[model samples]
Target: MKFIEEVVVEEFLPTFRSMLAGELRERGLTQSEVAELLGISQSAVSKYAHGDVDINDAVADDERVRETVERLADGLETGDMSRVQALVEAEILIRKLERGDLLANLHEAAFPPLSDHEGPLDIHDPEGDLRTTERVLSSVRRGVRTLENTSGFAALIPAVGSNLVEALPDADGIDDVAAIPGRILDIKGQATVPGDPEFGVSEHVASVLLAARAAGSDARAALNVRYDEDVVAKLDAAGYETVEFDAEADVESAIAEALESNPQPDVLYQTGGFGIEPVVYLLGADAGVVVGTVRDLV
Candidate 1:
C-alpha cells in the first residue's frame, strides 16, 4: 500500500526544492551556495536545477507555493529567515495543504481507495482549516438537501430568496461561514439550488448568525424564510424563544440589541420595513438541525 506521505516526499519535495533552488540561482546564488542553504549536496542541486528530477507541476504552480518560494528566497538571500525558520514555514504550509487541500487531493488521486476513506485521515490535522472547512461545507450540503427534499419548502422561500448557512466552530467573519453560493430561489414552486455551497457567500443570513453569536447565542447555523404572524406564533408555541429585530438598522447591531435580553433565541424575525421584506430566521446547532427545524415547522 502506498502511503499518502510517500506522495508528498516523492512529488512535493522534489518540485519545491527545485523551484527554491532555481529561485536562489536567479538571485545570483551558485549551485554550491544553494546546496549549502538547502542542506543538500551540490550534485543534488545540479540535478534539480538541470530538470533531471521529475517535478510536480501542481506543487510548482500553486499560488501559495510561488509566493512562499519568493519570500523564502528573498529571506534566505538576505539572511532574514534562518534555514530552520524556512523549513518550519514550508513544513507548516505542507501540513496545512495536506489537510483536505491541494496535497490531500493529490494524495487521494494517487491512492484511489483513499478517496472512499472515511473521516479525517491520520495525516490531516483534526482542527485544520481544510478539514474544518470541508465539515462546514458538508453540513451545509446536508441542510440544503433537506430543503430540496421537503415538500412545500419552495413556498417558504422569501421574495429575496433563501440561504442555508453554517459557521465554523470559531467563525470570525463571513469567510468562516459556509453557505450556498447563490441564494435558494423558488422557481415554478420548486426550490432551485443554483450551485454548490461555499464560504463567505451569504451576507444577510451569515451576518444575522454572526450577530447572534456575538450576542451570546451558541447557534452556528441559520436559515431564512418568508415571515408571517402564524409562523412566529407557531415557533413560540413550540417553545422556541423568538425575538424581533429592527429591519432598517445595521443587521449585526440590530440582532445584538434584540438578543441582549433574550440571548439564546431559537427564532429571530424582522417585519417588513420600508423596503426590507419580512423574514424569519431559524437557528440551531448545525445546518442539519436548522433545516430539520424548518421542515418540521412548515
Candidate 2:
C-alpha cells in the first residue's frame, strides 16, 4: 500500500538536498548561507556537511542530477540565479528524472509490483502530456469510487448503464478518452465497475465529450446518468447551465446544436425517444468536479 511519493520524500529529496549542500559549500558558500539558500535548518546543513546523511548513490552519481547541482551551485555562488529560479530549475530536473529515469528506477526498487506495469510510469512528469492524461484517468477513478460508496448511486444508473469519461488535453477521437471497459451498472442494489478503465472503451460518452470540446466547451470530463425532469430542474436552479438535444437525432449533431446555442453548459440532457433511454450528462473541468456535481444531486 505504499505510495511512490513516499519513496521520493524518503530517498530522493534527502540525497539531492545533501549533494546540493555539499556543492554549494565547495563553491565557497558558508553553512549559514547554504542553509538559507536551500531553505533548511542550519543543523540539517551541518549534518549534510559532516557526512551524517546517507546519499543515494544512484541519484548522486547520475550525470543529469550532478550537472543540475553544479549549475545551481555556481549560479547561487556567483549571484547569477535567484534562489527561486534555482529551486525551479532543480524541481524541473527532478521531474525529468522521475519520468522513466533514475527516480523511476528507485520507485521500482521500493515497490516491485510497479515493474509489472505495461509501460514506463510517467506519473511524476509534471509538465508532460502523459502525466496530464494520467491525471484525468485518476480523477475518473476517484469519481467512480465516490459513486460506489454513495448509498443510492446505483439508483441513478440508466438501463443502458453509465460511464464516466475524461479526454486527454488534446484528444482527437475516442482513443484518447479514458473510460471503463464496460459500463457501470446497478447489480443487486450495488454500483459495480466491471473492469479497469482503458482508452477507447466508451463510444457514447466519448463522442459527447469530443463534441463538447469541438463546440468550444472547456470541460474535459463528463458523466452520464438516467435523466429526470426534476433532476434537470434541480440542476438548473442550482445554477448549472443546462441544454437539451434531440435523442432521435445524431448524437454529435444534437450536441453541436445545443452547444451552438449555449457554448458552455454544465449539464446536457435528452428526452427519451421510442426505444431510446433518456440520459443527463454532468460536465466539468475534470472528473472530480463532474462527480461532485452528481453528488450534489444525491
Candidate 3:
C-alpha cells in the first residue's frame, strides 16, 4: 500500500507552518531572520510564515513524493526503522527531479516504485472523532500520570502519525503531558550503503523530528557511523547535527547519556538506534516512561 495518504500535506502542512511561525514569533525572530536561516528571500519567509506559501505542496502532487513524505512522517511518529527506510527511498526519487537525465536515470535506479493508490490512505482509529483540546489534554495527563506513578524511569511514546488530524486522538494534550520538559535526540542507527539510490532512515529521522519540533520539543538528529564526520557535516548543512556514540556503546546506555547531556528536559527521540530491539528494552525495563509510535507504513 502507498504509505502516505494524499491529504497529509493539505491537512497537516498548515498546522506545521503555523507552529513554525509561532516559534519564530516566540523567539522574536523576523522574516529576515528566517530567510537568512533557510537561505531564502525575506519576502519568501514572510509568505511562508503568513501561510501564503508551502514548500511541501509544491512537490506534493507527485505520488512518490507524497508517499516518501508519509514514510518519513510515519517513521518519526512511530519510531519504526522500516518506515524510515521507505522515506530514504522516497528522497532519492525526489532528487531525481534535479538530475540531468531525470526519468532515464531514475529508470535505472532499480528501487521499488510507488503504488498507484492516489487518494487518502486509510488510517483508521474509531476513537479519533472527538478532537477537543481538553480531550487531548486529558489523555496526555493520564499517560503522564501513569509514567510518574511508575518506578525508576518513565518514557512516553505518542501515537505514530503524519497529521494532527490523525495524531490528535493519540496525542491531544501531549504538549503538557509531563511537568518536566523532554529533550528530543533523533538517532540514525544504520549506515547507508554506498551508491544506494534509496535514502530511507535519514528521511524518517527528519520527519519525526519535524513533528516533534512542531509539538514544542527540542529535537536533534544523531548517528554513529564509520563516516561520522561526513554524516555530521551533512546534517549540519541541513541545520541539524548528529551525535556520535562509541561503536561499542549499548543503545540504552547511549540513550541515557543523551538524555543526561541535554540540560533542559523536553523530549528524547532515539531514531536509528537498534530499532525495535531498544524499543522492546525500553518498554520492558522503563515502565515509568511512556512509549508511543507514529508511522505511515508498519
TM-score of 1: 0.66
lDDT of 3 by residue, 1-298 (tens): 2222223344334433444443544456676654443345777557766667644433445565555544444443344645336445644653454232233222223222412211221223233222233343344344334433333221222222111111232332323221112222112321112221111223322333334334343432211111223333443454432333222355345544544544223223233343221111111011122222111001
Candidate 1 — which residues are off by over 4 angstroms? 1-3, 12-123
Which of the two candidates, 1 or 3, achieves a greater lDDT against the reference? 1
Per-residue lDDT of 110 in model 3: 24
Q: How would you encode candidate 1's per-residue C-alpha lDDT over 216-240 as one tens digit per residue?
A: 9999999999999988888888888
User: 2 or 3, which is superior by lDDT?
Assistant: 2
The C-alpha stretches of model 2 lying farther than 4 A from their native spots are 1-124
Output the worst ten-in-a-row residue range by lDDT, candidate 1.
115-124
User: Considering only N, C-alpha and C atoms within 3 Å, which residue pairs clash in candidate 1?
Assistant: none
In order, the Cα lDDT scores of the candidates are 0.89, 0.87, 0.33
Order of models, best TM-score first: 1, 2, 3
lDDT assessment of candidate 1: 0.89
The alpha-carbon deviation from the true structure for residue 110 of candidate 3, after best TM-score superposition, in angstroms, is 39
Model 2 TM-score?
A: 0.62
Lowest summed lDDT across 10 adjacent residues in model 2 is found at: 116-125
